[model samples]
Target: MSAELEGYEQDYAVLTAEITGRIGKVPRLVGDEKKLMILNVEKQLDEARELLEQMDLEVREIPVQSRSMYSNRMRSYKQEMSKLDTDFKRSRIAYSDEVRNELLGDDGNSSESQRAHLLDNTERLERSSRRLQAGYQVAVETEQIGQGILENLSQDREKIQRARERLRETDTNLGKSSRVLTGMLRRIIQNRVLVVILGIFIVFTIIMAIYFSIRRH
Candidate 1:
C-alpha cells in the first residue's frame, strides 16, 4: 500500500510540475486578472490535494477496523480529481480551436462584420483561456502538495519504527534485570539456610559441654 501511494505521488508531482511550468511561462500572453485567477485556482487545488494526502496519511495511522471510511473518502476524492482533469483538458482544446478559427478568418478583410467576428472570438478565447489557465494552475499545485504530504508520511513512518526499536530495547533490559534479581534471591535463601545450620551446631556443642561439666561436679 505504501509503495503504491508513493509511486502515484511521484507521477502526480512530475505531471503537475510540467503543466504549471507551462502555464507560468504563458503569463505574458494572458491578462492580469486571468493570471491572478489562475494563481488563486492553483492555491485552491493545493489545499484540496493537501486535504486528500492528509487523509491518506491518516489511513495508514488509523486502526484497521476504521480504515474503510477513509478508503471510501479517498475513492470519492479521486473521482473528483479525475473530473477536474477532464474539464481542464476539454476547456484548453476548446479555446485553442476558437483561437485557430479567429486567426484563419483575419485574412486582410476590413469589413465591419469581420471586425465584429474577430472581437467576439477574441472575447471567447480570453474566457476559455482563463478557464484553462486556472485549471492548469490547480493541477500543478495539487502535485506539489501531494509530494509534500508523501514526505511527511515518510517521516512519520521513520518515527514509529524508531519508537518500536526503543520499546524492544527496554523490554530486553527489563528481562536482564529480572534474571539478576532472581539470582540474588536464590543466594539469599541459601545463606539463610547455612546460618541456621551453623547456629544449631554451636548450640549442640554448648549443651554437650554443660552435660559433661555437671556429671564431673
Candidate 2:
C-alpha cells in the first residue's frame, strides 16, 4: 500500500477501536447521553468510511502491472471496515434492545420501586402531620416550646415535598428521553438496511456492466 493508504488504514483502525469501545459500553449508558454518544461515534465512522472510499477509488486508477494487487488490498480494507460497521450496528441494536426492556418495565420492578418509595414517603408524611398537629395542640395547651418543634417539622415537610416533585419531573424526563431514543434507533436501523440494499444493487449493476463488456469483446 502507498504511504497515504497506509496512513488511512491506520486512522481507520484507530477510529474503529475508539468507536467499538464506546459501543461496548452503550448498554451501561442511559437516556439522551447514550444516544448522543452513539451519534458522535456514527459521525466519526462516516467520515472515516468516506475517506476510505476515496482511497479505494484512487487505488483502482493506478496504471501499473501491480494494480490488481493494490485493488485486492483496497478490497481487504473495505471488507474490514464493513465488518467493523456491522459490529458497531449490532452493538447499537443490542443496547437498544436492553434499554427497550427497561422502558417497558417488563417485570414491573421499576413501578414497584416507585410505589414503595411513594408509600414510604406517604407514611412518613402522615407521621409528620400527626406530630405537627400534636405539637400545635401542645403549644395551645401549654407553653411556646412546641412552636419550635412545629416549625422544624414544617421545614422538613417542605423539603420532602420539593424532593418528590423533583423526582416526578426526573421520571417524566427519562420516559420522554427513552421514547425519543427508541424512535431514533428504529430510524437508524432502517437507514442502515436501506444502505445495505442499495450497496447490493450497485454491486450487481457493476457486475452486469463488466459481464456485458466482456461478451461484446
Best by TM-score: 1
**Candidate 1's TM-score:** 0.46
Estimated TM-score for each candidate: 0.46, 0.43
Can you write out model 1's per-residue Cα lDDT over 70-127, one digit (the tens) per residue? 5565666555654554444333323343444464575534544665676677667657
Model 1 weakest lDDT span, ten residues long: 88-97
TM-score of structure candidate 2? 0.43
Instruction: Tell me the tens digit of each residue's lDDT in model 2 across 48-71.
Output: 778777776566445444566765
State the displacement of the C-alpha of residue 18, model 2, in Å, after optimal TM-score superposition: 1.4
Q: What is the lDDT of candidate 2?
A: 0.71
Q: Pick by lDDT: which candidate is best?
A: 2
Worst 10 residues of 2 by lDDT: 139-148
